[model samples]
Target chain A: MEKIIGFYPGCSLEGTAREYNESVFSLAKLFNIKLEPVPDWNCCGATAAHNISKKLSLSLPARILSQAETAGMKSLLVPCAACYNRLMVTQHELFENEELKSEVEEIMGMGLNSPIRVLNVIQFIQEYIYPGLQEKLSSPFGKKVACYYGCLLIRPHDVLNFDRTEDPQTMDEAMKMIGAESIDWPFKTECCGAGFSVSRTDLVAKLSGKIIKDACDRGAEAIIVACPMCHSNLDMRRNTIDRLLGYKTEIPVLYITQAIGLACGLSVKQTGIQRHIVRVDWQRLNSCLPEKMIKEEEDIHG
Target chain B: MYYALYLITLLSKYMAKEIYQNNAPHTLNNDLFHEIGISSARCYQCGKCSAGCPMAEDMNYTPNTVMRIIQAEDRQMDLELLSSESIWLCASCEMCISRCPMQIDIPKIMDYLRQKSLQERLQDKAANKSIIPFHQSFLDMIRYTGRSYEVGLVLDFKLRSKKIMQDVDLVPKMLSHGKLPFLPDGIKGKKNIQAIFKRTLRKK
Candidate 1:
């Protein structure tokens, strides 16, 4: 008898990082774990929603959890940090506030299961997905890589409470399972200035430049990101950083899943390497990932 | 380019010594702060908000320090580059707001400072060139269309900003894999979105 957790991957799945969504699903099958999808979901109302109303901000994610509760899901597994934070905070507030639970029910038309649990993708994988996946590791990545968590995933302490939000690398623990090294560094949870990458590109570029510079300064081979928004700012915005800093800093940025997927015999192309602006063309990276990941493109496309 | 030079010149006076005082008549006075729903009086002067702000170390006055100034009801501090970056640098991740003991929505205050700074063009020295235009283009897109059309926003931001050519080598690959969409498709009920945006002036 295997346990199946309810999965709530946010809108990024619909675009940007479809591979992550696919990789998680495929990896679940490999681990003999079931990931049932939460039905009829809406946006988690990330950084944008708080501007509207704090109550509404928390309730948006709470509505999804409420749906999960109605469907009898004791715990919900969320992939995106922004979503994980909101959902987890709602769970925290609901359990803490007796009156608010009934108030939220009247607003959302559903109730959270008492003691409703919300786990980040990394948290869930580290606890449930790591052990079984560890059995299939074909290579070890002792490469010095900075694990970037950035803001909501770890901050405010009360919500999610996974790791030190400022300098978190719990992915280092999970990365170890698939046999990869996670460099311990200070810039892990530093803000990439994600949303502002568009509005205030200059600030984002300078800060992102600093983040990459810190990782490179510490001799990191690459930077691992879990959030698509973070990934976009840190990785895709490389050209902007280069123009601002007047140098080429082509550091590879991969979602943790892609790294694990590569280690577990998934292909580089299969991990969505092409979508990255700063390509990870490191020789050491080449040596750490398994041969299967390298040949994966040929196998799938040929 | 003019704004960037303008901001740098403002920070030029701070070259002798970064004075924490720049006197500019700001709309963020006591009454205005209340109008925006940020109560400076409630802030405990705990530098946590400043400490948590990603751009605080680089800023002249931190979000926490700004709150302290607003709390003590002292409005004489010079907050040029610091306030601008403090507000602009906020990713709006709400870390400061979430952590505040008094539960002040510092991010909103930060947005006000950011908008003011951008409007005044006072502290634009190191504005993320690519990031800002990308943001303006996106806002313009949303302003034109109710909700964002990711494909449209991406295409226009890149094309208009002249950055598409920089990444043109990679666009072929992105388009090949369907990572970049060909059309600008937006949310169905755009009128409702327009109403929302029209009804509420976020920082104005």
Candidate 2:
């Protein structure tokens, strides 16, 4: 029997991070885990709600959790770090304050009767995939990559409480599991200007430019990330980042699932590698694959 | 002579209180505590928040300065802080709260201030004009479709901010990659989502 877990792909996964969605689902299929989408799920009210109304922020996530509870999911796999953070923080806030919780319940028109575990992509991998990852690996991803945790995944430590806030090692450990070297870099957990990606493109350029520069300076071939926002800021905003840096940097940003998928014998198309705006160099990644897998790739193509 | 000096001192103190009362309606510190249960009084001029802030360079006032201004508890300073662009510029990265010795929850305070700023129609005072419109556009998408629609959000933001063609080049690339879908995937619970928005964010 396959393990079943709730999956919340959030808005970005549908829109700008379609590759993330594909890679996540493909990895789940490979791991024999079934991802159940929360039925009729609404948005988690990302930064917009919290910035304007506290009640809306708590209520939006509360509704999502309520739906998950109704569906009898013990644990929810939120691939987007922003949604994961919002759900976790909302749970914590509701648990701490009965008045606010009831108020949110009234607004949501549902009761969050049971607590459901909200897991980010890193935690999801650590929980379900890491145990059997070694047995399934067909190729060792022999490359040095920077594991960028971004802001939401690690900070507000008391609420999410997944790993070390400043210097997170969970993604690094997961990278190491797949035979990749996680580099020691300063901007691993830095802010990528988050939702400001659209409004303040210049700010995203500056902040994301620093992260890309650091990864490149440390000789990282790719930057591994779990958040859609971080991926977009680093990958989609590459031209802006390059302009800000006064020189072009070619480090491709890969979702952690995509990196793990590659190691687990998934093809480039399977992991949606072609979706990236930065243009991931397949030749560079091909060199990192095991000799057997490389020969198999050539045989299939030839 | 001693009694006269003592009486004058007491009178001056009373007059000062009256003058302060006449000047400002309410202190920002008390309002923040009442609104969000976060107290700026705990912050003791620690610059750690500003030091760790990613956007401090572009902000009109740093996080520490905002906290200090809130602690001042004066009406003018509170209004100034609310209307200041610093509150709007906060990325809510939580770096300050994570590292602050006091654990002041500056992000929550920033949220509360942003709400107050919008309520008082002081958002125009924000120098970084595009931030609020982007947030509004994002919420508008969610309100209608029950999820964020990137193309709609971009169009709405462009219209609101009038800074069209800022990232016009990325749209074609995004469309080619199948990242930007022409139509939004609306949830079945669209009405419920609208209710959530209407109930929680009631119009002033």
Candidate 3:
């Protein structure tokens, strides 16, 4: 039986975070997990919709949920943290209030009282990738990594209800499975000043600078993230971050899927590693892995 | 529960006083509290929300102070808070709500306040000139397309701010990395999405 799941690669995936989208698709293929993009999915309305209009925010996610349910998708995987937050918050709201749910149903022009679960990237990996990880491991990703959750991945605990809102460690555990060591850091769940990346680069710089400085000071080779906005703040705005730090910091930010894909022996091109603003030298990365795979061809030739 | 009752009593007292003191009726505080589904009257001003806030230093009024401002029901103070850098600087991280002993959703209140501020055109001119326009352009992008069209959004914001040359150098880099595409792709059923926005507006 094919393990097919619905996928929602929100706006960021289509633009500004293509690497995240590519790496996720690559990893899914490697794991033989069939991912089906939800039919004609719209935006999750992220932080903008809620601030602009409450009805639009709720109705947007409600429409996505209703569409996913109609498409026969029981579980929808949203890789971007913002998308997951909006979808989960919507689900929490609609499920808790019957009257609001009916109102949303009327607005969306569709029924939305279905049991559809929205999973963040980490949760999706935990369920689908962890069990088969040992068999797929080609080399241990040996470098020390700082798992950055940023905000919205786990906050408003009652609504998200997935990991510990203050100190989430699921990403750490997931990295450990791939033979990568995740360090304990204060800014793991800190706000990276997302949504202000373009409008207020100075704030993003100061906040993302502190996060990068902490990770680098703790001897992390790379910072792992699940959110595209976090990546943009930490990766795209590197010049601003470096200016605030008063020095150039070369700590590469890798999407969790990219990190996992590399560990699973997917080529750098396949994993979209070169698309990052901060470059990752795969040869150096190969030397950094804990355990080197002894190729059957090498053994036979030798 | 007793705290809730006492707070309600206090609020009712204020409401009664306002009704008696003026001929013109205004449901300013009660309507907001109702819209957000939170009882600001229950806030005892513990300051936990302020302490947890990462951007509190940038805020002219701290999260805790905003709660007091809302509860006081003073028209001037309300306008001040609505136009203050505090609401504009809020990252909407939900730390205030998470740490609040009263379990108040301060972000929801902030959202309401931002909406009101924009509607009234009372946004802090110096600080929010860029911020308000950016948010409007973002919503406009979603309104036209089903999702955020990054190029269009950036263009809209730049045109509004008239700072087109600000990030010009970075465009090629972004394009090279396939981060920003030249054309915006519209999803199927864009009309349906427009209807959703329109219906939501009508409801409001």
Candidate 4:
């Protein structure tokens, strides 16, 4: 029997980051792990609720956790860093304040029952995929990449308590396991002006441009990330980023799952590589793989 | 000596009366402490938070200055901090709290301050006008569809902010890549989500 974990892709994964959704499912299929979507799950409210109302922030996540608990799920995999942070922080806040918990319960119309364990993409990979990753690698992804953790994945240390706040190494370690040389670059945990992507694209351009420039200057071929928001800022906002830098920095951003999927012999389309706004340099990525795998991929994709 | 002691007591009582008369500062401070359990008084002007803040350069007042304003415990300073663009501009990256020697949760305080600013109708004083509208549009989408509809959110934001021409060029590209879905994927629990919103608002 395969292990089943509740999966919450969040809003971005369904829309702007559909490629992330495809890559995550494809990678999970290889491991035979069943990623069950939490039934009738609503939005985690993201940055909006917290900015507007504290009660809404706690209540939104509490409802999602309750749904997961009702489904008999002991663990949930929240791939989006923002959702993961909201869920984890909500649990911590509710546990610390009984008054708030009861108020949230009243709003949720359900008892905040057994706390479901929430896992981000990195933690999920570390637990289930990393253990069996070595045996499944068909070819090493021999490329230098910067692992961008962004914010929310590891901050408010006492609440999330997953990785180091500054210069996090978990994503780097995971990238190394898949045969990619993780570069030592600053801005691993920098804010990409996340929620400001739509409201203040200029700010996102400035902040994300610095991250891209640093990665390129440090000789990184690609920037790998786990968050869709970071992927959007680095990949979707490439034109703006380039405008800010006064030159084009054509470094493609790949999700961690997509990078690992390539190493595990998944096709480019399967990993949703073509969905990216910044055209991925297929020739360069192919050059890093084994010759036979490259031939096979070319025959199928070409 | 007896006369001197009487005069000292009179001076102390006068100062206490003057401080109590100006109750706005304590109300703001006490509200923050009671709501979030974080006191701005804990900030000791280390400037570490401001130094590490990514948005400090863009903000009207740096993170430390906002802390100092709250620490001053003056009515004028409280209004200044609340109306300042620093609160609205905070990305809530938690860099300050992570490195603070006193472990002050600046992001949480920013959230509280933003809510207070809106409640008091001090949002007009915010220099960065689009942030609040974006947040409102996002929540509105969730409240309606029980999920964030990107197309709806962008349209709603554009309507609210009246920046209609912004990002128009990216729509075709997004559509071609299937990044922007024409329709929102609504959850079956839409009614439940609305109820949650209503209940939270009623409490407020």
Ranking of predictions according to DockQ? 2, 4, 3, 1
Runs in model 1 lying further than 4 Å from the true structure: A94-115, A284-302, B1-52, B57-61, B74-88, B93-149, B152-173, B181-204
Q: Provide the TM-score for each candidate, comma-separated.
A: 0.71, 0.91, 0.90, 0.91
Please state the error at residue A220 of candidate 2 in Å.
0.8
Candidate that would win on lDDT: 2
The predictions' CA RMSDs to the true structure, in order, are: 13.1, 7.2, 8.2, 6.8
Global lDDT of model 3: 0.84
Candidate DockQ values, in order, are 0.14, 0.73, 0.59, 0.73
Better of 3 and 4 by lDDT: 4
Docking class for model 4 is medium
Ranking by lDDT: 2, 4, 3, 1
Q: Compute the interface RMSD for each candidate structure.
A: 5.3, 0.8, 1.2, 0.8
Give the DockQ-based CAPRI class for model 1: incorrect
- Candidate 4 residue-wise lDDT, B115-200, digit = tens: 89878868744434699889988988988899998899999999988899999988889999999987755889999999998977
Tens-digit lDDT string for candidate 1 (B1-204): 999999898788676354434333443555436556566667667677777677777666677777765655444443443334444455766678756777786766765565555545555544535545565555555545533445676677777666664445556655665566444445443443344334333543
Over the stretch A69-104, how does candidate 3's per-residue lDDT look in tens digits?
989998999999998999998998888889999998
Question: How far does residue A65 in candidate 1 sit from its true spot (Å)?
Answer: 2.1
lDDT string for model 1 (A212-300, tens) is 87776566778887887787777767878777766566568878887877777767666666656666787744433334443785788
